[model samples]
Target: MSNRTGLARVLDDLGTTLIDLVRGDPARAGGIGGVVIDDPHDDQVLPPRALVLGVGVREPADVRARLDELGVLGAAGLVVRGPVVLTDEVAAAADRSGVALLGLAPGASWTQLAALLRSLLAEGEVTDSETLGGTPAGDLFALANAVASLISAPVTIEDRSSRVLAFSGRQEQADASRVQTILGRQVPARYSQLLEARGVFRRLYRSDQPVYIADLPDDDGGVCLPRVAVAVRAGDEVLGSIWAAVRAPLPADRELAFCDAAKLVALHLMRQRAGADVERRLRADLVSTAVEGGAGAAEAVRRLGLTDQECVVLVLALADSHVDDPAEHARLLAERQQVADAFAMHLTAVHPRAAAALVGDVAYAILPTESEDRALRIATDFRTRIGDRVVVGVGPVADGLTLARSKAGADLALRVLRAGRSQRAVARVSDVHSEGLLLELADLIAERGDTLTGPVARLIDYDLRHNGNLVETLSAWLDAFGDVAAASAAVFVHPNTFRYRLRRLAEVGELDLTDPDARFAAMLQLRLWRPV
Candidate 1:
């Protein structure tokens, strides 16, 4: 793989298909630290050598102003929607800031552009230093470009579901629908429906021979360019397909080359899938070792690229839904993996050194920051974005060796939330310390097989035998702090009736309501027996 890392590499890979260089010099740009979408509504910290996406900025004046701002922040490049007019003012701004200006292809969505850039940037972060067939392992973009070169046409690598995994440059040579497909990263429903209606996929997957598709009519009373597709296979299983937009049918030699490329693509796809699984397992092991803290913890932390800094641990788990059906359980497991991947990506965007991995049912993250408050905000924001199905527990900031302590605190906080003891979906240890302690006490009692023996226990026994509301009455009265009227309202009874029940329970249990110690004992027993 090429050692290119920033604007130069981005242009080399995605130039004609997704982006175009408009001004400044790619050579001047340094390595890209991160990719960030510029949000005018909020104040966002930009990492050094940042690539800023100007999603909505269009006019020359606005573009110029954004260039100047990004330059001050030491951003390496600015990307705006294209057909960009290279006016003198815009050129001057780019030169003054020493920031490369690129134009995003028209008809491509900002979401698509951001995803492409992030994936491209992530390739530079891989430490494996392994290659397959002269290209970096799992480098689908490079594979796609290679296939395109062999066929003498633009190409796309697509999965079984017809989702575009990678596309070569010169996508402009294809029809408008091809551009739309590349932009959305999937074949549009209309196009796929048409293909299905024609039995194109069935024919393509049925044989090793290339299936040639003639021009198809579009919704705009036009026709798409012809295409030749071949299914990629590993032994008997069909992995995906390679699609090429050609102006005419290929001659015999090119057809042979196209088939050979599919075989190569199959090897790459299998390697990519295997590599991802191995990487995930390795990360999980590293995260487990670091969070457990001990002899090997410091080394594990360093391997995760988090060392010599105060960091907080965040543990996230799905709220219990008590799912029992086998199909639902499988779906739930898949969803957990998806959420973990998203969490890892989100943390990476926040801080390049942040590490996250799914360990069992929970996702653990090591965020390199000392401020628990900032960690809380980040957790809260993530929870809000992911919805109420998930909960996050943030731990105190700790040094490398003490990360185990932070992990413990986070686990306890997560347990409290999972037990339904707190209404919050995101909380720090301090916010739920009392509840966590109560849960631990309950666990101790359960472990020892201890039964209730206090006044509250007697009240419970009497209620079961006589069908009385004594325990409820006492509980409400104690909860109200001896306010008879409030306690009566709480249980929806008259004050006199509530008072009578309370006094009757006291006599039956031989309890003294006036003594502070007695009250404390009764309250503690009630909480342990039935937590609120």
Candidate 2:
């Protein structure tokens, strides 16, 4: 395929020797699809995507009129001469029309630029020269350096969000902006602000072709370097981008080489993603085996490289919403799992001994902690880092052998949170103890029904038959620990009336009202069994 680049890049490659007095928003420069050398008087036809407008000197009115014509023809940008006096009306028209305005150096010839661009546009495959001339084509750093050498510029590989992944390590060509971006592994906020202002990110995400940013100025209009970037994609999915900083437009050969290198970069990203998926599956299997109480559970934990830790705390997070479509649900589940793996990677980066897994839509982490405080900190960090998509549940610290119990605790906490039984984002095992126990008991009560608790069942039957508040009064009395006034107030009834209800309950159920053991059983039953 023909190597495609953005207009901004084309300008940068041209350099000050060939171009000067560039006006209009540099950020709005479109992806250059072809070159259009305008005849002095003939009609001009704009090309698809983006096209470079080449013209000789024209009056300001003519310039504005051409801009209008280009805008109507859906032209991406325009290119003109520096000596061609640019009027405010023309500049305003260019800005309003979203056409990138370019002015060439006084001595620059349109013919030279046209020849250079057309040749590059026609060139196809790029041969590897430097690191990949004789060496294998698998090393990522080598690929980056090779592309840089081919283009005679500093190169950096970045993801879609402009995060610097690898650089060619060209110290001589590195500027303040490049240095900071490499060191921080992301574009600096100030630089990002300038690019964002011109809608560069929006255009980058939308276009598959290379975006050329020429002489990008700082937010304060300070001189900035020029860069050419092309998205590394697999079919329709954009994986990352390759950037090259150059003083002049890349030669046709080098432009072809950069395009070829992009295909390799796409392969690397796809392999990386596949490897991560395999790692997640392996880690999840280990965690599942450990939590399911297998004889090899300790072996599995050891395989994860966790040792010399006093305790392991388990944390689980579950997605709050569900999707009905199977494909979409699976995609969402995969995204969630990727998020969980990233969480695990973050934990390991900080603590070295932490491990995590994704079980369906739920995420689980087994973190080695020195103390309760550290575990709490990890839990808090998780809550802050994972954001609002999932509800977190933290289990108490336990030894590796008892990891299953901790996992169960976390699962219970997650269940409670999902059921709307808790308001906190990070629900701890201790926090959900009462609710968890009640839910477990409720399961057993539901399975056994009336056979499990005769007295509570009798009271429930009596209330159902008479439409009375006997069950509520009894439950409130037990909840208040046998306090008459508190229980009466809880039921919104007079103390004397509650006392009379208690007497009637005791007589109807044939139960003792004074025995503490019997009262405790009744309290447990009341908490578990649903009243009729």
Please give, for residues 1-532, the per-residue lDDT of candidate 2 as tens digits: 2223555545444344345434665545545556666654643334564455466546778788777777766676777777667678988888777776677655444655565454334321122332233422234444566677777888888887787655675634756677656545578887778878988767776876567787676545576677777778899888888888776677678777888778778876665566556767888898877766669888887787654455555555555557899998788877786677777765654454577887766777887765555665666676677677677677767777777877787788878888776777677778878888888877776777646447777888888889988888888888888899999998788999999999999988877879888887888776565454
TM-score of each: 0.93, 0.63
Candidate with best TM-score? 1
lDDT of 1: 0.87
Q: lDDT tens digits, residues 14-74, model 1?
A: 8677788999888788688778888767557677888899989899999999999998999
Off by over 4 Å in 1: 40-48, 59-62, 85-89, 124-129
The C-alpha RMSD in Å for every predicted model, in order, reads 2.5, 19.9
| Candidate 1 backbone clash number | 0
